[model samples]
Target: MFFLPLVPINSTTTLGRQSQYPNSWDVVRHFGIRLSDCFVVTQFSADPRPTTASDALPAPRLIALDWGTTSCRAYLLGPDGLVIETRSNGKGILQLSADPATKDAEFAAELTRLCGDWIHEAPHLPLLACGMIGSNQGWAEAGYAPLPSRIMAKGPALTPVETRQGILHIAPGLVKDAGADDHGLPDVIRGEETQLRGILSGKESPASSIIVLPGTHTKWVLLDEDEVLDFTTSMTGELYSLLIHHSILGRHSIPPRHPDEAAFLRGVDVGIGTESQEEGRPGLLTALFSARSLAMTNDLTADAVQDYVSGLLIGSEVAGFTRRWVGRTSTQEPPRPSITICANPSLASRYKRAFLRLGIRVNTAADDTTAKGLWHTAVLSGLLAKEKA
Candidate 1:
């Protein structure tokens, strides 16, 4: 059993920016509710840590890892762009043995068992890992390089662990402080960065663009070419979960057969156009009670509660983005650079339609693209020193 007490990474927080403390603690507490002793992992990198290796051809030249909070996924990319073999284990930074005296040995053994069988054929596989597994409180805090700057995918400061079979390099995560124009947004991500970098690299003419990554904490990133211009975080998903499951709104919800309900659309319409739709503007709490009132008055049905909730969520998202995106758009500004939603199938489909109605293009980036992106970041970082040599 592992315990992660959602410690506030930034306690002396600034004003005007969203609070990361309450939100993070809320998630940690919610996660612990199901099982107090269960081990958990997290994955939320907006870029991959690139490393540049100085070594010549060794064995495996390509290695990649996407380590999240709840789970970790990895791939060993062959020189031919195909996965030669894959390895994974229940062990992640958050779940690794807490007893530091033996944690490394335990982690190495578990990791080796997951990859050792193939290491003999590819003894020197360079590895790269993204996500929460590399945070300061994580396995080892992978340092951040800052915005308007990007880490080159090459071998970085690689740490070798002697597993039962041999050695392995554990990839690190990035951390950064807020700078000018960033409005002091103290946030960090792990695995998603590699995916974003990969997505941008594959483009025919990659330049400055806004990247929308939908997840528990949706990240809106500003990229100036390869450099990450800046970014901001939103807790819409967590807020949605809280309102529907724990708040009074939960009473009216009947578990929609479809997550995106028409009721949701109506809610969005009311919330977004509230200034023009109603005589007096209402707060979110007031709006929430209205849903239940509507249901009781036969103004809405049980099935309609789902959409009503959806409307709250979508409306909130639209409002947030509207504020963030208003003065940032232009007919020549790359057409909003298709929203990249990293979420499950149901919500993904729903968000696609929601965004489409707003005249936005949407598409799902295949899972393979994420893996390839991490692999690309590793090669850029110096992680493959032994393999590349």
Candidate 2:
């Protein structure tokens, strides 16, 4: 139902004895944050709380907080979702003490530092939060809502934690019941609730849609109107990154630039091709050989080689999903689900072009589609009431 892709950034290099977020590792972390397989960190901000008690000045309606693994993102949204101001802090859930002894205190302190002033402005104003802050490792595990239930469903709500500053609501990640399906399906997602909700909010009456959220573990979410129907995951992005940058494939090719359409599409072509291999399909090895082989054997250009590499990754992803779709058990005609690609514009644009070129129609959702969807779901389901500005 609700689709949220969780992609963890792998940090193989250990931080030296610097007692600090090491610069070299930090670059990796920054790259990991940007190229994170799980979630995306778009912008960061810090804004002072309103202090004037004048009746003419009203406090912000609700604060949309996306407290993730590596960062805390807070948005002071107006009644219409227009951001009045935003704030962020380096204190993410991972940084919180998992030891349990100091977790609560540290979590509270981080929240206070980031939002205490804002709470003073509107002590009674409601707050909505989503992401890992509510996961098993978070301050509190906000239990999941079941299939066909929208993100804002009343089935399982956020676990509220009260502090001297104000009340904090932590969004729960969706987790399927054990043995829900074969392979002991243990599907769970943290930060994607808002994104899925944002997608539903765009429509007057949500249709039966299948959203493809491409990343480390690509999520294929099936939605029936506002309700989440079912879902599955694919390790597309993570595999590509690992094979190209770290694994054996790295021996051959150069690093790729961000927004490299040529490389991305090239990956799609090779990966999605029917004849990849039955034996482990050493995608990286094949891609490496393709590049080196091209250089050694013929007079191919660097750009062409890059394109070939990209095709290998994307091609694999497409091919895998195609198998899942076609091999799915059903006597009925294939689900007439619209493919909505929810991701960054650049990625979405590339996917749009690629899918189109392959005769697949995909509608690209807005950039902030996830956050907005979460807010709208909350409002529609009365998990959050519409603000009166």
Model 2 ranges off by over 4 Å: 1-58, 88-90, 152-156, 178-182, 256-261, 274-310, 326-335, 377-389
Top candidate, metric lDDT: 2
Q: How high is the lDDT of residue 258 in model 1? A: 55
Alpha-carbon shift of residue 389 in model 1 (angstroms) = 16
- lDDT for each candidate structure: 0.55, 0.59
Worst 10 residues of 2 by lDDT: 1-10
RMSD per model, one decimal: 15.6, 12.7
Evaluated with TM-score, which candidate comes out highest? 2
How does residue 28 of candidate 2 score in lDDT?
34
TM-score of each model, in listed order: 0.68, 0.71
Model 1 lDDT tens row, 286-379: 6667777888899888877767766766665655564465343222343544356555676666565555545556566544556666655655
RMSD of 2: 12.7
